[model samples]
Target: MRHLPVLFSAALMMASTATAAPHVVASVVPIHSIVAAVMGDKGSPELLLKGSMSEHRAVFTPDQIATLGTADLVFIVGHGLEAKLAQISGSEAVNGKTFIQLSDAPGIIKLPVREGGAWEPDDDEPAPAAGSEAEGVLAFDPHIWLDPENAKAMAREVAVDLGKADPENAAAYAANALAFAAETDKTSAAIAAELAPDKGKPFIVFHDAYHYFEKRFGLTGVGSISDVSAQAPSAERLGQVRDKIIAARATCVFREPQFDDKFVQAVIEGTGAREGVLDPLGAGLTPGPKAYDQLIGNLAESLKGCLGG
Candidate 1:
């Protein structure tokens, strides 16, 4: 009877004490990066689809789902940006908890899909896509976090969400948000100047992932070449791309870090345009650099090396 009383008291004390910090499972490294800045040692946070894994086609393993049970928040790049995330999250990944969609965040600027098969509206007129943006089905560019300024905004939003989840640490979350935003601004400015009058230059990306970057820095992405997230284009489609390259005289065609480079090699042949890979997922694959500040520097340096070389 005496031992039972002690055990009951221990259980009561345990129940009275506060729980551990909530865990966050991020769908993209950039999201994880920003959140990590705010979380510091406060939360258990990890990147899920990591590295070159296409967010659009990320496979949700049973082990990954098990980890999700521990997470209080799951942050995803929205608007179908995370290929099958909505489905997996709703059905399995979220573990019955709600997740935040970055695409839904305030200050997110969505791009319109041009009818002429371009990734954006004309430089002169920026209009939302037909039918979709009108109905508010897809209002914002899902890749807003790609731009450092916008990423700062996103960081604030995430901080607010985190604060709501842990009111006790609300002050820390806000402070971290402000600090990270300042850092992002500095990083972005450095990158913008490093491009050195090449913002107006033309280049082709294997995917349309960099539209937010182009919009932020006044760069022009000439065209997109592949659907690394989905099916590879057919040979005929590639022939058409070659024709477009000839017509545009683009500087170079960009590939992605995780994709097979065979098609890119074949297409760039005889065109004088070189091959380079843009890493969107960050060091989720390699652990090169994890923070947004370093990420921006890495991107700028990569661009300088690939384009200026």
Candidate 2:
């Protein structure tokens, strides 16, 4: 009878440990980095999208599906950025799991998806008005994590969700989130200094994926070779991009590492624009707590390298 109490206490401790660690899944690399940072040493979140897979074109394998099905919480960029995962997460199959949509995270700055290859000269474009898009369709650009401020907001959201899921480790999650926010602020300040000289310096991207980052640092992306869908630009679109490149005197034409650069060469030919590579998804980066900083820093370096800063 004396040993029974100790056995019961030991069993309770094991049960508490299990409940303290939640099985969280993140939809993409950046979000995964944020979630992983917030979780700190408590646990690591499973990353859904891996390698050079385009979030738009992601198709889950059986194992990934099982991961999603079993996760206690799933963090997504939302706004249809990961449509397949979003659909699966919302479906009745995963109804029991909680989804933290970063797009809806408080203090996130949302920008409407810019139209066409050549952007308007103004950066003050307003967001879509209420009821503008079809039901369940997202009209805003979903790359909300590019801005460090937005990333800070996402960290808070992740910390809150994790705290809810693992109340026993709630204080740890909150503290880790604060540390992540401080790191992001420091990184943001350094990047701002690095990019300050390049403000209003025109550049072209392979796709229109960096508006949040551009808008954050006052960098000007005059045009994109690919449209919003990342489809190869049509001949007409390419011609327009070429014209924009020359007209804007773009210093660099940035190609994404995940895609072929042949089209980029086609656009930059005779335009005197240097070709640079930008990997917004951190395709080459190993996923971890440090990835988000590297992703943003790499972008600044790529821009500076080609922009002659």
Candidate 1 has which clashing residue pairs, if any?
Answer: 51-285, 56-83, 110-140, 110-141
Candidate 1 global TM-score: 0.83
lDDT for each residue of candidate 1 in 112-165, tens digit (9 for 90 to 100): 542244343233332324432122323444566777767777777778877766
* Candidate 2 residue-wise lDDT, 157-181, digit = tens: 7888777667888899999999999
Off by over 4 Å in 1: 1-19, 92-94, 114-140, 227-231, 284-290
**Candidate 2 wrongly placed segments (more than 4 Å):** 1-20, 92-98, 120-138
TM-score of each: 0.83, 0.87
TM-score of 2: 0.87
Clashes of each: 4, 0
lDDT (Cα) of model 2: 0.78
